[model samples]
Target chain A: MNIAVVGLGIIGGSFCKAIKKYTDHRVIGINRTKSTAEKALKEGAIDEIGTHESLENADLIILSMYPQAVVDYVSRYGEYIKKGAVVTDVSGIKRAICPQMTELSEKFGFVFAGSHPMAGKETNGFDVSDADLYKNASYIIVPCNAGDSVVNMLSDFAKSIGFGTVKITTPEEHDRMIAFTSQLPHVLACSYVLSPCCPNHKGFSAGSYRDVSRVANINSTLWSELFLENKDPLISELDILIENITKIKDAIKAEDTDALKALLEKGREVKQALGE
Target chain B: MNIAVVGLGIIGGSFCKAIKKYTDHRVIGINRTKSTAEKALKEGAIDEIGTHESLENADLIILSMYPQAVVDYVSRYGEYIKKGAVVTDVSGIKRAICPQMTELSEKFGFVFAGSHPMAGKETNGFDVSDADLYKNASYIIVPCNAGDSVVNMLSDFAKSIGFGTVKITTPEEHDRMIAFTSQLPHVLACSYVLSPCCPNHKGFSAGSYRDVSRVANINSTLWSELFLENKDPLISELDILIENITKIKDAIKAEDTDALKALLEKGREVKQALGE
Candidate 1:
């Protein structure tokens, strides 16, 4: 099987590595830069460097670009992809891109199964890509115009590459949850580092500080696009989180132990419920 | 040297282990419950289980109890401690307890140097106690009424027990930094778990969710006491953190991409500055 991975950055480069390592698929590297493609080629992540004109030969194409870039790619290359071929993405948010990709898939007779693999690092680029990046991580399959057989093959591909679970959800549900689990955390981490106490936190921080601030070191250029693309849901998540933070603040200001204890207990209960 | 740990919980038990493992001190474990003391002894965390009467034999006694409980224990038994004996605490916050401890140290003729070890687990008790828990962790020696020699000895002792760095600061400075670094992170972790989206986060959650929520599983009884004990400093910290959260919320609400990007960039800067 021929597989083309678009945008040879971290996610895309990782997909090429995983596909080459785990399956018999002839992985092809596609990137906006020759340097990145050359790096992926040297890393042995792809069989050959492929161009836009050769995209129709790909039996499965994975769009590992940002949300906006995914939309643009599907729009530009919708008519060029092979008929009845399967295409997926490693995009963070789905609501904005999946609908357009679904329409394009239908019009072009290709399968655009929107996927989101819940794994990556603070570092990016092809040089940092790892074949084992997706091991024990989630890979959600957002059902677009892509049919069951296409999704099954994609799921098999995901599992073959060491994804722990392959879940199915709508684009709306995916975006809503992503806003809470992914997008909100990035916002919280970013805001947390801006605290007045951060400069003096040199010798004082431990597990909690490290855990909460790990994602604060993020890719601004990509995340800014992600934050606005899923604006409504992300804003809603921000509201809920702000309310939660305020609740703790009010409890502390009042010095109400019972109220504070109750809130903390509720939080503990929520943490228990996560069972992660 | 004879070392007494007055509370055979997680922190206290770990202290006993560290003292026993690193130095030739005869470590004695004391607790409100005899079972905990016996368990600490059986686990080799303590040389022997000691009573309040035997605390006078301890040349270096550590008050590894919760904030309110530590206050109660010291007030009741401060008179029984040995003259010129060095005493310290492994409490999370220092402001509420340090002044009172200083007064007690003066009256009782014992040295009280406040110490905050920035290392702990979500779990509690002697069963989970580790001797090397403090390795490469922050250990702050807060100067109260304790003399320079006693503070120096305490710092050396902390370093001997595998601490990464031994810092010296005023009680007020320690509390201010801790309010942001320690207490606020706990509050954030606890409160972050209470999001409405949490119950539904089964397979969708990954590193960031896990990172932010790691400390959510907390010792509610102890944390509630700590929060109330350091109410003033903690409330101010909470105010600042909530304001930061609100800033991001406003940026997202306004769809101000530049502002959002700047916020994210600042967070990245903070993360990089950590040098961890």
Candidate 2:
């Protein structure tokens, strides 16, 4: 199988490397910056640096870019993509991107499936990409009008490349869950670090501070785009988080030990039930 | 030197193991549950299971217990402790504990200084205690009227047991800083995990989810006491956090991309400046 991976950032570069490392699939790397593709080629992660013409030969096309970029790329190069080829994306948000790609795929005679690999590092770009980035990570697939055979192939491919679980769900469900699990945590981390006391946390902090503030070192531009694109769901999650925090604040302010203990116990119970 | 570690829970047990592994000090382990001290002695983490009488021979007495338990033990056994012995504690909150311990030290002739080791795991108990738990971790000391000699000795002892940095400050400053750096994160994590969406977060979660919810599997009884003890400072920090989260929530609700981007950029800048 010939796999064309567009956008040689960390996610794209990692997919290329994982495919090359784990299977006999020929990987063609494409990127806005030719240097990244060239670097991946030199590292033997990809068979070649790809042109738009390479789309015609690809059995699978993975768009590993931002939501807007993924939409634009498919629109611009849809005609060149081979009929029956399965096109998937590794974007964080999917509700807006999947429908647009599905419509474009219909016009171009290709299959569109929206995918999100639930794994990443703090750093970005091809230099930090790893073949094991997807190891033991969850993979979500939104079958946006794609046939069952294509979805099954993508699920098998995800497993082969070290994904421990592959969940098939609608784009709406994916966005809703991502809002709570991914985007809200990023927002919480960002907000948590903006406190006046953050600068003086050197000797005062431990695991909790590290865990809460870890995602604050974010790709601001990319995240801002993601936040705005999934505005309603993200806002809803943020409101609930803020409200929940307020309850704790009120309990602490009133010096209500029982109320505070109850809240903390509830949280522990919820987490305990998850058995993570 | 004789080292008496009272309260053989995770922190106390770890202290015993670390001292045994890294130094030649005779360790006497004491606990409300005598079985725990016996286990520590049998495991070679301590030279003996300590009695209250063992306090007479100690050069350093470590109260590795809850804040109130530390005060109660010191008050109950103040007469037994060797004169001029430096006594310290590993409590989360310092403002409340330090003054009481300081007054008791004056009455008992033992020098008192409060200390908090900035290290922990989600799980507790002597069974999970690790010898290297303090390796490269921060240690904060509240010099509650202790002399320079005692402070220096405590600092040297901390370093010998694998602490990378020893920060000396007032009880007020320690409580204020810890409210933001330590306590607030726990509150945030607890509140974050209480969301209805947490149970279904299996395939939808990744590093951010794992990090944010890591501390939610807490010892609720222990944390409730710590939170109420440092009520004022923790409440102030929680208010600030809620306000900061509100700003992000407002921007997303208004669909103001530029404002959202700027807020995210500020968080990134703050985290990057920390250089962690």
Q: Please write out the lDDT profile of model 2 over residues A1-276, one tens digit for every residue.
A: 999999988899899999989999999998888887888999999999998889999999999988998889889989999999999999889888987898999999999999999999888999999999999999999998988898999999999999999999998888899999999999988999998989999988888899899989899889988998898888888888888889988887787889988999899899888885
| Model 2 TM-score relative to the real fold | 0.99
The TM-score, computed over Cα atoms with residue i paired to residue i, of candidate 1 is 0.96
DockQ of 2: 0.85
True lDDT of residue B38, candidate 2: 80
The sequence of per-residue lDDT tens digits that candidate 1 reaches over residues A153-269 is 888888999999988999899988888888888888888778888877878878877777778888998999888888898888777777887787787778777888888888888
Please write out the lDDT profile of model 1 over residues B1-276, one tens digit for every residue: 899999877788888899889988899888889998887888788899899987899999988888767778888998889999998898888888888888888888998888888888888887787899999998988878888898888888888998999888887888788787788888888777787888888678788888888888887888888888778888887777778877877877788999988888888888888764
Clashing pairs in 1: none
For residues B1-276, write the lDDT of model 2, one tens digit per residue.
999999888899899999999999999988889788788989999998878889998999999988998898888888999999999999999989987888998999999999999999888999989999999999998889798888899999999999999999988889898998888888888888877788899999999999988888888788888988998888888888888889998998888889988999999999999896
DockQ of structure 1: 0.75
The regions of model 1 sitting more than 4 angstroms off are none
Worst 10-residue lDDT window, candidate 2 chain B: B30-39
Clashing pairs in 2: none
